[model samples]
Target: MSSAGGPAIGTITTEVPARLDRLPWSRWHWMIVVGLGTVWILDGLEVTVVGNIASRLSESGSGLPISDSQVTGLGAALYVAGACSGALVFGWLTDRFGRKKLFLITLAVYLASTAMTALSFSAWWFFLFRFLTGFGIGGEYAAINSAIDELIPSKYRGRVDLIINGSYWLGAMGGALLSVLALDTGIFPENIGWRLTFALGVVLGLVILLVRRHVPESPRWMFIHGQSDGANAIVEGAEKEIEEETGAPLPKAGRAITIEQRRSISFVEIGRTLFRAYPKRATLGFSLFIGQAFLYNAITFGFSSILVKFFGVSSGTTGYFFAVIAFGNFLGPLLLGRLFDTVGRKKMISGTYILSGLLLFVTAWLFDQGWLNATTMTVCWCVVLFFASAGASSAYLTVSEIFPMETRAMAIALFYALGTAAGGISGPLIFSGLTSSGVVSDAVVAFCIGAALMVAAGVVAVLFAVDAEGKSLEDIARPLSQRTKPTGRPAGPPSAPAV
Candidate 1:
């Protein structure tokens, strides 16, 4: 066996990963998708409400005395900063503990923070709660993306991930509509209405938490952690259920890789793995994430203000515009996600990015010429974001799939932290300042900057995008515990370790 104090570091061979990858798509899989995937919707809901309510929050009696810029600019930045912090901290914990455990805990954190945000009577309290809410969402990203990649079949991974991540817009749509109703003076008072909007998030989070409780721990994770029996039980149960549902014989499972089970991996090792072993991919992840982060944050957080300042749209009416934009973002992934797997990741990613950037540039020109009113401006946003949303969703799919399983969560966290810090935190602030200036030229400059970033990221994707479609995770990146490193390993079935 092994020494007690040294940690149980020994090789164990298992087919859990292969078994999971080979299973047919069934209702059981859909359950996992819906239960675990709803976190994105909650995030979308949170962000959309904040953006839509920025104008209302600055009113004389809206509880918080913050200016419109503070709500959309500083407030958005703080939320992103908190998300960055949470991703790093919780990402490490997820890899150390388990996906199911961290996801549950993270959602609870979100529920508590969001509920308390509704009770805030001051700027500091509201800002603190918003940060906390962001912390929960950031943690959810790491845990959820890791678990989804581990459990979903390789063939369907790309589409599934895109659709799930894109569902954030579904929540955005809901928030846009809800805020419209909530902000109406006839439906609710100014002070009470905004508070009620946040409180509704608590109710949604509670329902999602109940659904998440039933989602089992990742079997691949269990086996890696040395619980082979537990892993086998989970996979077997899934196979049986799928087979019975389909009324067909299941195919033989793929080969299994042998791994030396380690109780925990250190931060230093994780860093080395990212920077040293996968430097090119690290660059790719950063490029994809930052580009999308800047474009999305700038537009989403500041869209309402642009409507008010440039288009003379009322705060209450901005939700209808946002709802239309949200629908476009949601449909991008729904309509185009299959291409990432079928047509290949590189082409689709690059095409979407570049096309979206061009559209943004054209829209900027139109806005500068003063040829577009509120309706036309929103349509332009919808078109640009439709393409950008799908491309951004692919960014997450790329980072999650290209790295080794051991460092999966941390890798995602690092890119998200870096990208969000670089783009997300600054995008809103910059755009808010530009939009608040009420100068079309300044807004045009901001749009140009976002467009340039997206185009540059597209070029990077063409240069470094990994050809990972329809391939198993093991094929893409070998486990760190393997006897052979990824570069030296040949294309063949994995062999069992000597007992």
Candidate 2:
């Protein structure tokens, strides 16, 4: 048992970690991360495109009754609302059905909804379609992430997930570029831009479907679901390719657990596990999730909010400009992908939190001082997003690893749902309410408040976070090695890390 009164080594059954050095990765691993990440990117592209288009809707030829900002915020609100609902429902479904199945299904929903959204005309039609699209994206968040956690090898999981997670910015950047280019063309009318932007999403979705034929299921989930026969089939398939190259016996299984920590998982059951496991991991998971939900979403969703109203930028200029910022955000993760291994999860995450806060403060300061003009402000926002995305990307990686695989998805869903649901609702709401209330005049003032919130996020991580880099799932879950005291207290994540 752990020093904290959790499971002892002999208490529950789990696979033993093999030396990562001996393992060879097949294309399957990369495909899973990149493929799933690409789906998220498409979702991100659609979202950014919606933001670009919503800002122009009322002024477009269709003549929707609402103002562009109103449509944008309302569409976002509906989107977030759909996500909140999707998270609650799909988080459970992903856990119950397994990640890969749900991942593919959610992609289909997103593709269909994006097509519907493109065809929207009236305000109600647009709102409904966007809400549905957000709902699918919400489902994607849980399924894609859970699938990545289960599919990838433990040693490289964090880095893989980070790079994949980082691709959300790629989608955003793609949308921004397309929107800008389409707008600059002048051949297309104003309303046509939104349609073309959404059409790009359809193309991306089709690409995922074609490539998805090559993707595989989660062997871990198969193992847990009493499908060891099926899991072995997958392992054997991966093994065959490796053996071909190395001319050797592809290594075999970990020490299997006698008693699985997870029994039956449902959404309500997940809630029970989070609180009932009375596990520190569970509680810490919730807190970290809550903190991230409050900060990350607020910052991401609030970006357009700041640009449109607080920054006093014209509608025509904002979408194309924001696109550049999105490109940097995409690069931040893809370029720095290796740091999770070299720097260690604790320091990598801690540094990201602190640095993001510092950047946020800079953005706020520049805006408050009237030093950041449109060009400068856009650059600063992108830089802040780059760092913020880094920190935000890790929250899922850490949260999934902290729990045992038995309850891993449940824990992930619960924590993510709690944070994201709260965040999904709060981010746009807070920015709109606070800014519209006139409590803050400058965009920097609002950003200052955001930076302060991020500072809290930094403090939380440094105090609670532990380094998980290079550790196996078992090493993380019960921590057999570290807590070198009277009783074996596995080293937990340092206090914790958040958005």
Candidate 3:
């Protein structure tokens, strides 16, 4: 061929940007976030508010009417029971059905259950409502996290999810505010505080419905599961809109990956894929899942109780203290986001693990020396929570990113289910058991253990985990990265998928 005016035989251009598979934060992102946030907030409230409410319930001779010890024991029991159910049920449903549909159904159950509990005539009713709410919460935790992980650009995935999840702190603060205000009025803490607080969940659920209406079924998932038409439509619509606004050529489409007709894959196949196809990622997911569960449950469930019992803070004061602590939680993820993208994934997460551990060690020392009494304790806890939020958020984001759309829900659920069920149950079980058995002074011990575990997990992650920040999802989830090792991993698609 002539060099100057002649046509080349094999010249090609990619119309799609590398970032297409990953979506930027837009109005769609916000709408879906609100949907996910509502579910997450309720989950946070359900776990955290129990400590404050247990005291209220016990004093009023309502629902179990147990002593402080009994309240802790039963609440822990109920929570674990529900969480176990969640890990099993919701994760399965999320993968088997559509994320968008399951989103609606789970919220309805949460709203109805919480509303019923608010008007309960006795403790039995309250207990039942809590169990049901717990169930809804369990399912939602798995679904929303998986959905958002698949919905966004791999590069921006961590920040999008972190911001979405950071709203959980806002939810906790709301609960704390309500707890303090009610207790101060001498109305809620006396007999009906827990009831009113739970009703707030119903309001949250209603709001979720409005927001979720805007969230489409996960496009990545649709493509993976043979919903090609649905997947193409979601991507094409977004592309047309982007082109109109930016005046750019349409995004490039990758080599065709036809959605084959076949019987639905079995759960065992998903499990085998996790364990065999990508064992290291599976292990990473497991460690992060369990470690975070330990960290979060310890803080959320045990903090209020320690405030009331050791510090002698009034219920209102405790609420304010908890709210301040959560403010740190809300900020932690945002701060981490800036570094998470620039620094490689391992560097950022490994740092979070070490820093979080050190912070908690300092937090424990402050609490032990009585240096953190009341106001100081709240301040100290906030600092600790900030670091903890960073580690926890990174863990969740990584888990979501490490798996593919075909098995992402199951992969996420497997770790989350095992870790959350164990850690969620363990936090309350340990605190209540120690309190009842006189084995320990307070809940601070849980933080100490959590920090140590995080350090260990961080070390493991750095040693084995691959850096995934800024990579494509298809590339990130490819088994050959490790399974077919020694042939250095390749970078980028010749053409990118229309995200």
Candidate 4:
């Protein structure tokens, strides 16, 4: 292959996919997980800190003159908007260029923007950087999810994807506890405490950048883009390393596939693939994303205000309650993730979404009756999120795997941007209005809205969820580049119309 402006383009028969899917679990795989998956922690930290610090930032001496409602409502909406925009631009670039390059570039963008946020002198300055931070994170979603799904073994893919996506809550837990300390005037001055939280996010991002440097480009991507030699070398290296680690030779790989290699897929092809070639899967992707995005945005962005206004909890003490629910969120995916593989994707995904939604409906009724304190409310959220979190993480898993190889990143970007825009942008705005009003009826309305969406998404899952567990991605959705046979048949049409 020539090292020029782009990868050399030509037809190539390769077994890169089968080789990758057959490897045993080893330390090398763990390295990839740690490097790629840890970014969600930073995202969780960014979101949770902003929510938890809204009240602090609105105080008399906090330097920025933002109000609580603006921070939670307008600021949160802008962040989601930035994320939606970033996902589209970067998702296309990731598919065209490569996963490693885009992931690294996106992370650097996040680090710089977050660092600037720490030095903001006004509310507009704070809001601008928040949007930029979301932009970087949004790109990470497209690049990272496609890369991880492409790289992980098929047997471990379902559970691993769930746990990695769910790791966001671990960062949420940290941010919640960190906010308690930062908001305390006894430890940090009012003006400096919130700024320190943003600064710390930058620091953690820098550490992750160092580790992410070593993660490889997806071998699946390389061969399809006309770098078959590079793809073969990577698979061979992995096989050697795994064999040494396990003290045994590996099994023979499955059949090779013939691919008419290309530089990139077009937006028109991507749209047809999503809407025409696989409409049912597209519906599943949108439903799962919209449901999770709205539910998470409503609760995550508005929970602090709900505690302070409705239950009379102190601003500084709200983090303790938030932390309990964040733990529940993380535990949900970690504990139940394996079940997605064991019991199967269709059953597990639908079950979690429906169960969580019903639980939230009950919690909303109790809150409407004024029969709960801050502690009881937090407990209710903990139980509701225990299932919702797993269901939410699976949304990412579903989008990444159900699409063709060339369109994986863009597919993830489209579903995330459109679905999140529908739910995420409006969720915080509505919840912020309701919770800030301090009216029990208004808050209950917000809860019911979120609960209803989850139930609706669960019903969609029952109708459309793919049975993707333990199946090779090629089997689920053939790459656009793949040919019908080695010699007998002509290469299939180079578009989704052929599918």
Candidate 5:
């Protein structure tokens, strides 16, 4: 392994970013996707398992000494708090050290924390472990998003990011299915079944860690940090592999942007970039993130409760319904993701957000009219989330793409922390209260609120979203330290036929 070593402080210009962007897709890209994208699945699995087993955790025979409210309420709050804190701390570290390093460390943190969660006997212990688990997952978001955007070709960046982030729903579906088996009393003891759920996620994380070990550091980060030799080696290796796979010549390298290399970046500069230099983009990021966070956290946290309260559904059966909904969520990104590249980011982003919000509104009205049963309501939710899921995933894609390279991780961390703080904490509490009220009108009001926010976010997207589709990260926002300026040409036009 090359030491990702670079200068302490200096200036350098390199075409490493252009070289990486010009390469045709090959097995190497898929390897990057699988190794890095699995974190979201682990996150979705952990979250879904905990939500599905909240009832089991509260049972006297489940070994954990915790009430249902404690498990679902306080525990969830601690996890979100930890995630928010971790993003800030790790986001800065990712920018300072390197993407590959922090991503590996974060996954290790998640594997260790989640494995420990199965051994927790008391509520405090369980809460602590959950927080630690979230902390790791939060760090993964910052590190992985940066690395993926840097490595993936700009032309395919949108769809790749959407699909990768959307992989969260795949994990959700897996968790829902696993919960049905693991939570079944016939299969295992009450205490052991739920424990097995946490263990399942740990096993998956371990596999991902092994795969990630073969993944390399972001060469773009290396070049900017004054490690030209290391960056050139990586890009050359990738080009060779890709050419062998495609059996053709690679595209002409694009013009390189010159940049000043710095060993350290201050939080003050990151803040300046967001609020001072790119205020509208900053606003767009907040609106998208907060709206999606509120909608997702609310529904995901209260999904089973809604089924039980409104439709006389059982705890065990909720997983099946949620699984069906999770499938819809996954399909949204897989099917529609390509449009983000071809149709353009702003239009597609706005369309998904607004359309999903409208669907949710219609679904809310149907529920209020007493026209929905468990099956029909699940179907409606599936339709609504099919669009909302894509929109939500795009929010992460948006924040990750629109910022400068120096503060890219921190920018994502900033929006995620703020959005999660605003919506992630209060959303579940509000929805839980509404669902528990036994009044359809109360639940209807909650749904309407989420719908309205989604619509507003869509409007914001229309007004403020960056037209970043098929654009390089460097083209989208020049690095803070970039000394050379562009002269009306994109990092050179595509030099080879689109593969």
Candidate 6:
């Protein structure tokens, strides 16, 4: 094996990806899940806490002079803007650098910015750090998703990815409950509670950073970047460790692939690979992302307002309702994720999206008719989101896997930024305006729009979703650095199967 800093520029053939995919589930895989996947939970906690605390922050003696509208509207917008900007910048960097390096740096950024947010004494300071905090979390989406897809076995990839993405709701659940306690006047003073919430995020981030340190970089990344010896060492070590842990002989790895290794891929090549080389896939990615983004933003941004205004549910108790809905979101992926792997991606992705959209249409009709109360409305959202969350989580999985390995991180970043922008910006603006209008019909229109978009995306899924369940990443989309075998044509899309 070569040294860690050995040459990173040559063609080499290796079965690193095959070896990784063929391994039996083991303790080491769990370590990767805990180390890498937990970041989503932190993100959920960050976004949720800010939202729940917005009203408190706008109050007298809360220390900041920000209004409720400023905290919820402008601050939220800046945070999302920061996240989109960060994803694009760090995503490109993650593709350029190794996953381990970028993931660590992104997490550090989250910790530092969030920690500073806890100390903010002014509105500008608070808003600036919120954006920076989002910046760090945005980078995590690209780096972590790429690493997780590359590292996880193909058989378990669909469920694992969905669950990891879905874990954001788990953090949302935590944040919802945490805010209830944080905002309690008996437990904490108004000014102190909000600051402590941000501090807790920093504490959680620090722990995640510690666990993440032990996780290794993607070996597939190493081999393609001309670190073949290091790649082989890592794979071989994993194979040996899994065998010992599982107490069984391991299966032989599948076929080896040759590559024309390089240190980096240019944005021009990345663009061509996504648009020109795989235009259908680019469309699929956009459809899935936009659909899910709008629906989530519509419901989440308007959820509390709807309860308070239409149903007369008190603002103080909205957290309890949100926690229930968040739990439903997490459960969707946990219960339905295995089906995506077993039933196949096309059928499952489309089914979930379509099902959720149909359910939302019914909910909208019921809301417009004034036949539902707060409890029933919450139940309706819980049901609708049960399917929507699973479909939404699959969007990330689809984009990450369908692109070439060289563009994996950037693809995840681009789709995320686009989806988040579309949904995060438009969903909130449209839904908030509708729900706050004190007209039930207006809010119903917003819900219908979200539902219609979701249904349309599902229709697209039925037409274009890739049948990627249990397939090798190399088989789904061949790496750009890969070399064709003697007498074989140059690499294109995998001819194995289609949706």
Every candidate's lDDT: 0.89, 0.65, 0.66, 0.91, 0.87, 0.87
Give Cα distance to truth, residue 109, candidate 2, Å. Answer: 1.3
Candidate 2 yields a Cα-based lDDT of 0.65
- Which portions of model 3 show Cα errors greater than 4 Å? 1-19, 22-24, 61-64, 186-189, 245-263, 435-444, 479-499
Task: For candidate 5, give the lDDT of residue 408.
Answer: 92
Looking at model 4, residue 391 earns an lDDT score of 99
RMSD of each: 2.6, 7.4, 7.5, 3.5, 3.9, 4.4
Model 5, span 358-472: residue lDDT tens = 9999999999999999999999999999999889999999999898999999999989999988888787777777777779999899899899989999999999999999888
Residue-level lDDT tens digits of model 4 in 1-499: 3447876777666767777888888988998999999999999999999999999989989998889999999999999998999999999999999999999999999999999998988889988988999999999999999999999999999999999999999999999999999999999999999889989999999999999998989999998887777877778888889999999999877456788788888899999999999999999999999999999987899999999998899999899999999999999999999999889999999999999999999999999998999999999999999999999999999999999999999999999999999999999999999889989999999999999999999999999999999998999998888885323233223541110
lDDT (C-alpha) at residue 95 in model 2 = 68
Query: What is the per-residue lDDT of model 2 for residues 348-392, given as tens digits with 9 covering 90 to 100?
Result: 776776787788887777676667666788888778777777777
Look at candidate 2 and tell me the lDDT of residue 189.
Answer: 73
TM-score of each: 0.96, 0.85, 0.86, 0.96, 0.95, 0.94
| Winner by lDDT between candidate 4 and candidate 3 | 4
Which is better, 5 or 6, measured by TM-score?
5
lDDT of 2 at 297: 53
The CA-based lDDT of model 6 is what? 0.87
The 10 consecutive residues of candidate 2 with the worst lDDT sum are 490-499
The candidate 3 region of ten consecutive residues with least summed lDDT is 480-489
Compute the lDDT of residue 279 as modeled in candidate 2.
Answer: 57
Determine which window of 10 residues in candidate 4 has minimal summed lDDT.
490-499
State the RMSD for candidate 1: 2.6
Candidate 1 segments exceeding 4 Å error: 2-9, 484-499
C-alpha RMSD between model 6 and the true structure? 4.4
Candidates 1 and 6, the one with greater TM-score: 1
